[model samples]
Target: MANISMTETVLQCHPMSEKGFVDAIAVHVDRAEGGRLQIKYTLHGLVDGIDFPEVAQPKRTDELWKDTCFELFCGRADDRSYVEFNFAPSGQWAAYAFTGYREGMTELACAPPQIKCTAGEGIFEMTVTVDLPESLRALDVMAGFSAVIADKHGRTAYWALAHPPGKADFHHKDCFALQLEARSAA
Candidate 1:
């Protein structure tokens, strides 16, 4: 198993003036044997100023990124194909398979992820766990963690482990910076 915790994420620049509503974003990743992955996203700052989606029945959904959402991306080191997962605070989620960087995208059919969200004084958090698609289960993997944060004031900020120059492109190859070795058979 491999465990990783990200240092504070970098907030991408936006056209609107920033109020610094959110102070920090941190992501913790745990990759277990047999393709089980768990991720925890923690946001520290003024929780009331951040807008989160309303809770709904947990199901597969699209466009979760339009609000406050946590995302995960992973792929086999030897293949161009990759997978992206979006986890909304509302318990809805989305998964997609991509042939390459921003190429060929289709909804990925898999077991629904287990998502848990909590809010408290000055902090917000979401935890999600899912099984990796069968194709990616036995290979070395590269992964990226990111989030889309929307303030109640209609302003949004992009947060990622690393950002490509110019704009916030989570699909860029550079964002896949973490390396995880394949788990060997017992």
Candidate 2:
């Protein structure tokens, strides 16, 4: 078993028809104990603003936009925790979770602390890193998990290389790297 921690920046594009973007800073810690994995997440950001739609209709642009953001975090399993939040809209928070097993775990799975957001411009950033279990190395597991999450989420998941480890001032600007991390017991 291995324990890992990672910091990732999450960016979600607003509905093509809508304006503004949703950005979040997420921090995650994962501890692999036996067959079950324990994870924790913390997220904070604005839900609606001048860039986002704000109307009072069920299917209006504003409602649709916000709905899209929330639906992104809706998980299909019982052992996951999903949280949707916004700085506006009464300052209240909504949360849901899957507290059990999630089917189909052949090789990879979506890392916990999945994020959803609206659309906008500018460089948004989040950092997710992990404390690896003694038996596993950080490089291999982190890279694999990150690729799997990006594949499953598609455009909803966006990542860019801020800084490559050990390469002084050399970065991959054109390539965006979105990653998810998961583990299995040995």
Candidate 3:
């Protein structure tokens, strides 16, 4: 395996949502020689005010975005198909594949991701490592990192690497601003 490097990025909250107690959300992403993709999200804010469900056994679940959740979207730079992954602080996750922008959604089946989270004082952090689908490993990939944050006061904010003109649509290609070099066997 080659030495993997991580790219750091800061997410911006959508203008439509009020940026309450959250100061900033930062993400670190990297891919290994094979298909392993690792991402870490560090949120700086009034951590206690963020709604967090009790952590349970890690499992594949749906609709994690209803609360505070972290997300990743990735696809081949030359193709329209993409994958969306949702990671919740509660150890539950969901993955779906799309034929195109928000089209043909289907449950994705792959190895389960390893997720870990910790919060203290004013910081909340989560790390997720998963195996990328083989189809995406041989080509350069584009990715979008986003999050849905809900505070104790019932305020919800959408954060992403970039936002489209109309609304906070993570599915829009504009959000896939990060380019990740391909990892193929030499």
Per-candidate Cα RMSD to the true structure, in Å, reads 3.1, 13.5, 1.3
**Model 1 weakest 10-residue run by lDDT:** 5-14
Worst ten in a row by lDDT for model 2: 143-152
The C-alpha lDDT values of all candidates are 0.81, 0.26, 0.89
Ranking by lDDT: 3, 1, 2
Q: How far does residue 27 in candidate 1 sit from its true spot (Å)?
A: 1.2
Give the alpha carbon lDDT tens digit for every residue of 97-179 in model 1.
99988899999989999999889999998888888899887777888888888999897888777777767888887777777
Q: Is candidate 2 or candidate 3 better by lDDT?
A: 3
Clashing pairs in 1: none
Judge candidate 3 at residue 139 and give its lDDT: 66
- For each of the candidates, give the backbone clash count: 0, 36, 0
Model 3 agreement with the true structure over 9-97: per-residue lDDT tens digits? 99999999877689999999887777688999999998989988778888999989899999999998789999999999989999999
Error of 3 at 157 (Å): 0.7
Off by over 4 Å in 3: 184-186
Q: What is the TM-score of each candidate against the true structure?
A: 0.88, 0.25, 0.96
